[model samples]
Target: MGRRTPSAYEGKGYLQVKASNGKCLTVPYDNGPAPPAGTQLFWWDCETRWFCASQLWNVVPVQVGTADANRTAYRFVNHWTGLRLSLGPATAGESGGRVTQDTCPK
Candidate 1:
């Protein structure tokens, strides 16, 4: 028999931390809402442990809603890491859509 693949896999998520020092870090987005205020998000990259921009400051989501068919934004901060992050103005990017259809063999 051929090599069997692993049946289980681990899920991963990114954390964007903002620091009170006016620094912003971009990592990954999680399913949760956001972190609380006054906390630092610490992550060890290589041998250095750093936090994101949002994790530095205390930023919370003023309004949490859905985005359009295009994109969305948010204003949040890291509680554990004390990172700061924000959602600025909205701008459009390359626009286009493609629809794929499948046909069964006759």
Candidate 2:
């Protein structure tokens, strides 16, 4: 099992995913309507932007395989709505669709 460095945002209530180019994974405020579940998550080119509730995420640890107990990954759950992030069937094609939130699959 591999270990990762502790993030500065750890235990800060919200997890911010930043891209190599300095952009952040953001859920826009003006997402047409209220309730951010169906809103598409995208990268925003901003350094000092206020993160709204929709942009906040809860890290959910998920264990994979039985090889090592420490080997695990994470699922991002929206803070506003308790939905897990997923690539829907519509986005499975080569074209790829926007990242949306959905019910967690068992």
Candidate 3:
């Protein structure tokens, strides 16, 4: 779900999240719905020139059960794909990541 223009990714409020290892989170594919679930994710260098969808992530606050304390839990959703970052294919819920983009539960 990559856009032709970089309007959504430009200006303030957009951040390229990187890890301690110096690699930034990347989506790996650009074509709409091209990379199906189980597409291995990598922390590649961010595409600063054009600002790819895979480079930006949004930390969404989700509602969880009140087991002991009711606190907000967060899910990382890709700007373009609108998918969540899952642990891997085996447990891909909304289901994305280790980088599989599967439909997850509310």
Candidate 4:
């Protein structure tokens, strides 16, 4: 029998992210609808495709399919600004090996 899977957007979706300019960004993606309230977001790059939030912050590492219970130290970058907020010390996780092709910057 196949193994049961969990929802990808569970618990981590909808995070209220703040930018370097003190402008809060409303993330509504499947990974995160909006970042958690009061989460600090540092501008890693204005063109990179990913960001890293605080390490202690619990977030779902967004992947293609099969939602898992793996919490990593990285938050997917915002698509609009093309900047990702670093979450942890930048450790290599399972989803880190996977590659996602996007036409956007960062």
Candidate 5:
């Protein structure tokens, strides 16, 4: 994965994260309006097109409550949906995950 700081961040500290495939990582528009939990993420052309704003993320360092605590873990916060990324398909693991989806809390 790679990231580009969109001009929109304007030194505000958000990142537009993308993959080697040249696609921006974003939530699915198919499940609109703002998909629910477990709605798997999707890849798009990074066009700044409608529904693509969810691709912007903030990298937050963890300072507490981890197995090792003290900056050992990080969280990626979605700009649009305001949800943290999550691993889905219950059976997924470190080897690989069937999907990475974000939960929408009501």
Candidate 6:
């Protein structure tokens, strides 16, 4: 078995989450579904992609598990909407939800 790393997206910076198909997570601006906040996040080919303001995420470290737990995790907050990136169910074909400014679940 492989031991997971203590921290992955910790600290302040941009987070580019790559899919199994080698596409990076992106906030689409052209011909994409417009969320209430205006932009939606999606996966795109990183090599030939163009720059957009929504692509930048503010990485913030949050305490993992209980407060007494020494482990650390992170939340990717959108620089535009200030909403923390959230994941949906692990089921297949779920394309995730809109970026909303909500508190990080404990």
Q: lDDT winner among the candidates?
A: 5
Which window of 10 residues has the lowest lDDT sum in candidate 6? 1-10
Per-residue lDDT of 67 in model 3: 80
lDDT of 4 by residue, 1-106 (tens): 1111123323544243445554333322345444442234432222213332221123236434346654444454443333354433333264533222122223
What is the C-alpha lDDT profile of model 5 across 87-106, one tens digit per residue?
Answer: 77574665656456565333
What is candidate 2's local distance difference test score?
0.62
Residue ranges of candidate 4 with Cα displaced over 4 Å: 1-12, 18-71, 86-106
Models 1 onward score TM values of: 0.19, 0.60, 0.65, 0.21, 0.74, 0.52
After aligning candidate 3 to the native by TM-score, how far in Å is the CA of 106 from where it should be? Answer: 2.4
- The worst-scoring run of ten residues by lDDT in candidate 4 lies at 1-10
TM-score of 3: 0.65
lDDT (10s digit) by residue, model 1, range 69-103:
44444433333333443222131232422211112
Q: Model 6, 1-106: lDDT tens per residue?
A: 1111113333546555556777656665555543444334676665334334455566688766766667778787765456666643232245545433344465
Candidate 2 local lDDT, residue 106: 71
Each candidate's number of clashing pairs is 35, 0, 9, 20, 0, 0
Candidate 5, pairs of clashing residues:
none
What's the residue-level lDDT of 15 in candidate 3?
55
All candidates' lDDT scores? 0.31, 0.62, 0.63, 0.34, 0.71, 0.53
lDDT comparing candidate 5 with the true structure: 0.71
Candidate 3 weakest lDDT stretch, 10 residues:
1-10
> If ranked by lDDT, best first, what sequence of candidates would result?
5, 3, 2, 6, 4, 1
On TM-score, the stronger of 3 and 4 is 3
- Summarize candidate 2's per-residue lDDT along 1-106 as a digit string, tens digits: 1121125445754665666766656666565554445667777654344545565677888887776556778888766667777775666564657777777657
